[model samples]
Target chain A: MSVLSLISGASIPVQLVMAILLLASLFSWYYIFLKVFTLRRAEKQTAEFERQFWSGADLTDLFQRAVNARDSAGSLERIFESGFREFTKHRREPGTDVGALMDSTRRAMRATYQREMDKLESSLSFLASVGSVSPYVGLLGTVWGIMNSFRGLANVGQATLSHVAPGIAEALIATAIGLFAAIPAVVAYNRFAGDVNRLAIRFDSFTEEFSNILQRQVH
Target chain B: MAAAAIHSRDEALAGGLALAMHVLFLVLLVFGVSWQHKQADTAVIVDLWRDLPSVTPPRVEPPPPPPEVKPEPPKPVPKVEAKPPPKPEPAPVVKPDIALKEKQDRERKLKEQQEAAEKKKLAAEKAREAELEKKKRAEAEALKQKQAAEAEAKRVAAEQQKARDALAAQQAAAQAKVVDEYKRQISAKIRRFIVLPPNVSDAAQVEFEITVLPGGEVLGAKLRRAANSTPAYDAAVERAILRAQPLPLPPDPALMRQFRELNLVFRPKD
Candidate 1:
């Protein structure tokens, strides 16, 4: 029998398990591509904004451009814009305490950083869950299918390889598909997770340096 | 704005690529497996050498009897009659034509020599008339010797002709016997496969004209006529003929040609 016929001929639970793995694999692949593009753009934008900020560009000029950019600003740019806007607002208000002003500005940047991290880390948990769970689901189907085949063997007077082979083969397809679904999800999850972590670290260091620059401006 | 729009649009592209990839994977799996199955189907090889080497006992039977009977008969014929000539005769019984040509050529040369001697005798008689009576007696003796030699050659030629006729008859008889023996062997082999029908008479016989290949495979078996028998018996005989594929025939191809198409009569009791 062909693999397709064998798969179609499998017991209901096994087929269900296969269907789940296939869907999980497809979704993982989609999330993988989505995260790739999202992280790539985030990294490129961070590099570009960092270069511009450090290029001896005027703070007020960069702030005006970032404000004009608004909803379309990158993660790091949005963080910079929010901090600078808060700094400007407190500076315009007379008798505002310098330490409190710096504290509120850092708070604003921290909130923006949290939002950016959320966007970069989106769908990552789903990838991690699929990678961890699919193999077990496939194993469960295989075990159940093998149990059913052996149960069927009780009625037959002679138990032969031919009697048991198709069932075992069908059952094993679940495990094969399970590994198929899990391997890439695991690999992509590991790679993308590392990338997001590195970006997170870069954002953290940027916030610290930005807060220091703001304190100097206040003095 | 462009970057944000492009980023938002990429989900569709990613989903399409993922779906296309899965479809490509499935096509590879399905076709790859089927291609492998096809390769396995074509790999099965039938060894013809297995069939060719085991020349069965029946195939060994027909050739020896003909050669043994054929060579023995002709040997005694030449030994009995050609003893008087004492000439070095090399198997004249087997090769009568060559021996006959050699004898004729020798006789011609003897006659030419006699003619030359007669001419010389006449010339000498004219030259010496007193010795004419002696020359006539000598010529008469030479004529007597020539007549005896001619008679001897005629007797030998006649004996050779008689031996040839006997040898041809013996060969014909041997061939007929081998053909009959092969027919019996074929009938016996077919009979082994016959499933005798119940209530069929021992007298009932079915005749079939069967065509066979060189390898003894029965190409076709046709009922020449329905025996005064039931259809079940006819079917039994037909099945038997088919089962007895490659019916036993003489190994000699010349003899085998006689068996290519045979009208076989099968009787249940026989």
Candidate 2:
């Protein structure tokens, strides 16, 4: 028999671990790829929305789209939907005090803004989990392999270099694989997570600016 | 008035959040894919461990037998055997002729001289003739007895010689047959015990030192080689040996003694 064949007979556990790690890596990369496109599109949309909002386009048309065709609406439009709906409802009610109307509408918009923020943060935690934990998981597998190797050596009367080498080498492979699976996830997680936070701040400021615009329209 | 302003700001914030959420999900996917690629690479390495060292002794042609030497015949030595001289032939004895006329005259004269001086001499000669006739009869009887004894001795010698020749031939044939059969059975048993692996392509020689008992029961197996200590490959090899228990034993009682401890090689060949 050739030397090559003897080395490649993989057992079940190693295969399993490798499969799992591969799955996780694939998921993370998929997430990264999908996020890259999504983030780019969102950025473009926000820029377009800001440009249109500041331009002289009619507010009624925008509001109708925000209310009726939500697909075209951004987070800004949803916030407008909440506050405008409440404002309109109050204005139509008989004997409704003006102060109460504005207060309630403002509160409603604020709540919607918080909801949208939560939505943005969804699945971000999962990325964090993968990034933070994968390396350690790989470490665990490596350690387990090494422990098994050592235990096997106990039965041997005189352990030689080759005897220990293969086991140790196998054990180390798990760690290397784990680290390989983890590093990119962490980097992507951090970068994407920061982007989410920054976008959130922009959303908060836009809500304030839109509220000021709404006040002008009411007066 | 504040409510209208607040509405616009809230809408803006909501739009920004939607954008951010999309980005986050995309990031997760990329990371997941990269991790998957790395994991696949690891799985391949584990496969390498399994395939490297096949545990079988490779088949090769047996070494050519040493050249035969033709020995020279020894020189002939001369044997000296001297021939003895031939014995002389015995002379035939002549019988005295009896005449009728001579018998009558002699009888008459004998009667006349019976009481005279010549009578004693005549009586002595007659007594001698009677004694000679008795001796001739005794000699004839002894000769017949000697011939009968010689015949009996020849028959006994012939029977003894035939029995000895038959016994020698039977013993030689029996011994040769027994030796040949014993050799044949032992060869078959040793050949039968060799095991080939399931897949031959990636098969390797996995050598083990195994100890067996006289009863064909395996006592122990020790791994002499590991292709790679990867858990997958190593565990599989050990399990294969255990599964191959109860090694082949020689048929003859005496031949079985030769297999108490031996080294076996496993090569997985299709």
Candidate 3:
């Protein structure tokens, strides 16, 4: 059977499966692109913030800059600003101990790091689901299509290969489409997950280093 | 700030490129454009070595039995009675010499007769032996000729059989081809004649058998099987078969026999 006929001749259930797989593939690709852009931006902004923070810029100036950027501030810069703001706020209170100031600052930085990691890891689960489930869905369609073809065979007095082949080819198309949807999603998910993990590690290390620096200031 | 703007623009560009690539991929898939690979046509290689006909050698005829030798009858011998010595020669002292000379002459004649008889018997024995040798040679020659004739006859018969087998095979293949063509023509003619009733909406198949004469006239048509169809549907199919009269048959009488009784199936929804 020709590829055109295989697809056009598919039964209703198989066609529906193919349509769902195509949509899933399209959306997975979109997320893949979006996540790539988001991760790259996050990495770039983190690097830029690190460079500025270590350039011997005054702490107050860096904090003011981060505050000015508001929601647009990078995750690392936001963590720095939040911790510094908490330190300053508690410092103004009479009889505030150095231990309490450091505790509050570290806690705030840790919370921001968690929020940043969550944002970076968003939409990855969808890619994972697409990769894992599409094949079975396609399999379901293929089984149904084959059952229908065999059912047709029962009506025929003599079953020739020509009678059954087109139906089978149409059925197999679903599996092909399923694999088409799955392979790329699986590969992209793996790569993105690794990238997000690396970013998370960087954020954790940055928070620890910032806490140590603040601890030195308190002394 | 400039870096931020460039970064956002780059993000937008990446997203746009990704979207464009995905769209292109999906379009290629739906249109079945990118999956084209040159499918190499498989060449069918016939093995002539195995298909060559094997030639069988003719059977050898056994040698003919030896000719019987017949004994010749003995020739009749002539009998001579000894004559009584008639009168003893009266002793005549004077004629003794004459008597002795006569006896000597008689003994010499007898010896000459016995030698002639012995020579005649030897010549007859030699002639008999020569005749026996000639008969043996003639028999051998006749046997060789007979065997050669038998072998020639066998070889001719085998060749004739092979030719007949080849002809039969060729005829069968041609007959099959003609039958297929005849079936196709009949189907086309029937389909052309058929005007399906509009009210018959269900998917139905009407199978019927048609009997045609050698001259291509439709003798009779009867419905063999009916499925999801009414009597009207069956009647229409039968009528169509009848209308396609004389039903294009192969010109060969042998091939025409195939269409004499034919089972045809008609599917309304096909």
iRMS (Å) per candidate: 2.6, 14.4, 4.9
The residue ranges of model 2 lying beyond 4 angstroms of the native Cα positions read: A1-15, B1-74, B77-270
Model 1, B1-270: lDDT tens digits are 666687768898789878987898788888776623444445665423223322222221221211111111111111112122223323324356677787787677667766766776666555555355556666776677667666766666676667666666667676777778778878888999998889888778789999999888999999988667778889999999999887877677876788889999887778
DockQ, candidate no. 3:
0.10
Candidate 2 per-residue C-alpha lDDT over A1-219 given as tens digits, one digit per residue, 9 for 90 to 100: 111222243235654665576567666665665565555555666677778778967777767767775654566667778887877788788887757877888898899888877766665676677788777777776677778778889989999887776776666666666676678778888888887777777767877787677767766
Give residue B46's lDDT in candidate 1 (0 to 100).
Answer: 46
Question: Which CAPRI category fits model 1?
Answer: acceptable
Off by over 4 Å in 3: A1-4, B1-19, B30-51, B54-270
Chain A vs. true chain A, TM-score per model, equals 0.96, 0.85, 0.94
Please provide TM-scores, in order, for all candidate models, with all chains considered together.
Answer: 0.52, 0.44, 0.52
Q: Could you tell me which 10 consecutive residues in candidate 3 chain B have the lowest summed lDDT?
A: B49-58
Which of 1 and 2 is the better model by TM-score? 1
Q: What is the TM-score of chain B in candidate 2?
A: 0.29
